[model samples]
Target: MKPRICYTVWFSQRNRSTLLCEGLTATGIAGKPAELLELPPATSLLDFYQVNDYAALQAKLWQQRMTENGVFGMKANAPRKESDPIIGQLAKLSGLKVAAPTPYAVWENAFPNGKHIFLTRRNKIRQAVSWWKAIVTGQWHLEKGGERKVDSQVISQHYNFEAIKHLLLEISLRESKIQAFLEEGNIVPLTVVYEDFVKQYQQSIRSVIDFLGITDTQYPIKEPHYERLADELSDQWVERFRIQLQKDWKNVIW
Candidate 1:
């Protein structure tokens, strides 16, 4: 049978879906649903620059997790770039003969029966500041052992109101687009709040397993091996951003 698909729509960069992904894969009932489309080293089935048969490529990807009752979980980051690269990749794969694709169209095409999970944060200000901090510090993620994914030399961090403002609006726009797409498609996704998921790690994971209808609930859940990157500086930025945002009368995004 074709593998059941679980598509996670990440609101922004720091949605902490890695923890959720870890919990799902630890069950061994869900196949690895990583970003095979991301650039750098291409996944085997998608040697996009050379491969000509788009149909066969899609077929190979679909068959990767096929099993009796296995679920394939994949996540897509926010569409903050100038163009939706996923759609671009798919268009190239299709030889550009058809109509240009929308984000939801590409998702639906990949997994016709895919179930969606919406990863969001209630505090948009904090979420935006968290993203800005990572950019300034050059530390994208932190490991539990205190290791950091950082640059060769640590960049001195600073608070830039414009940068945070741009990110805040981008996040707002992303949430709006995602909700509109799901509503248009009549899809109800499992909404996982970043704030709540971090606090109720096990419960959130169980909820996802339940959403996917996985029967392996008795297995022990796995927590994220990474640590929360937020600190006193992050909190300060959150407060500063909210205060600075007062000048803008279009406070709907805040």
Candidate 2:
């Protein structure tokens, strides 16, 4: 066996993972990544793959989508505790090979010998706001022809200080954890930041394709037709959060 090559994107919510995945899917080389609808037990995987044994289903799917060069890809953002049953299940699955989950190192061990992409955002405030907005709106993504309307009733156009604070803390911790994991792994991933990707999309796309060892001629790559969900309210919330962080949460380093 020429090594079951699978690329994994280690990311958290509201980090432009969807946008990146969409772009990659457009390239026709990378298999779109999957996310757990809720948490473990991810019984949904059975329906997603339409099989009882998710392990076997994933194996077959990987083999089917894998190129001659031995590359298949998916997105992962699961609990990283060694005791978590989800980790065990993922370990048994064909693609993810998480041997242990200590701190934020689960992803590192999962694909020890496989290519990984560390997708993130630099603006923690914006990231947190986006997450909260998504939770309230219940719209994680907007397709090209999809409706642009966001459900105001979800969050009620009101800024929940507690929600924003919690999200900010979560995003900060995850970002720090990911950094530590990357350093420990001693692997420099093809880092994609949300801000940078949008600024230099064409170059970014090419870089990801090259990293995947796929020839440009292999797929007709096209730019994704999507827009950022952040609006004026998002900006206002980010500003408010920043002020709050500076005032009462000054001791906390985000």
Candidate 3:
């Protein structure tokens, strides 16, 4: 049997994760189709399988596993605190190696033997501004299918302007930590910038393919359409946020 490649996308909300998964699926190397593996809301690890109906989830996993043409990748938001064992077990059962590019420390630790891909967005100011708008307008809550509530205080606590700056800083710090961990010569991970990933999707995918030791024909990269509404505050908003991002950038190694 060919080696099964298991991938997990580690990203905060609205980080172009869906597009990345599409790019991975387009490669058609591993026989696995990319799918989202979301955990059920308000479920603890003890009752995760019971609440999630593992039978259906396992069926999807089997379908992806049975693919004969290309690699299989899955996208998910940050795993719940309790679902770690489930992820680990699924990885073992499927013989899949994990891949994540987010800054979540838990997934990083969970897949210690797996490859880590750190993806950083180029325009932090824009990202923060977008996040801010999403929260105020309840766009963030809507994406989770309205099952999860978006607490303004929690948002303020976790993602306020200052908090966003720290989040960027945390991303930078994790990059360093991953590098240092690799320096011990355990796991060598790949890093990609979001700007480069968008502009050169094929190349980015190629890097991922090569890292996984897969040889496949190139796939045409499709550009995603993104439109910004005509708003007066974009420039000023970005300018205000840019100061913090610039400071964070100085600390970022790559």
| TM-score top scorer | 1
Q: lDDT: which is higher, 1 or 3?
A: 1
Error of 1 at 145 (Å): 2.0
Off by over 4 Å in 3: 1-3, 30-37, 44-66, 76-114, 138-185, 218-220, 225-232, 242-254
- State TM-scores per candidate: 0.79, 0.77, 0.56
lDDT of 1 by residue, 49-151 (tens): 3455777766665655433355666666655454755555655444233486666666676665678788898888888888988888777678788865653
Tell me how candidate 3 scores on lDDT: 0.50
CA RMSD (A), model 2: 4.4
lDDT of 2 at 194: 83
TM-score: which is higher, 1 or 3?
1
Name the top lDDT candidate.
1
For all candidates in order, the CA lDDT equals: 0.69, 0.67, 0.50
lDDT of 3 by residue, 1-254 (tens): 32255444445444555566566665556333343455476553335434354444455453553346434455444333334544554443322344632323333333232454555566765655656656554654232223334434444433356755655565445445545544544544566677677677767877877776666665554444332321445455566666645665746432
Score residue 69 of candidate 2 by CA lDDT.
52
Between candidates 1 and 2, which one is better according to lDDT? 1
**TM-score of the candidate numbered 2?**
0.77
lDDT of 3 at 174: 47
Per-model clash counts, in order, read 0, 1, 7
Winner on TM-score between 2 and 3 is: 2
On TM-score, the stronger of 1 and 2 is 1
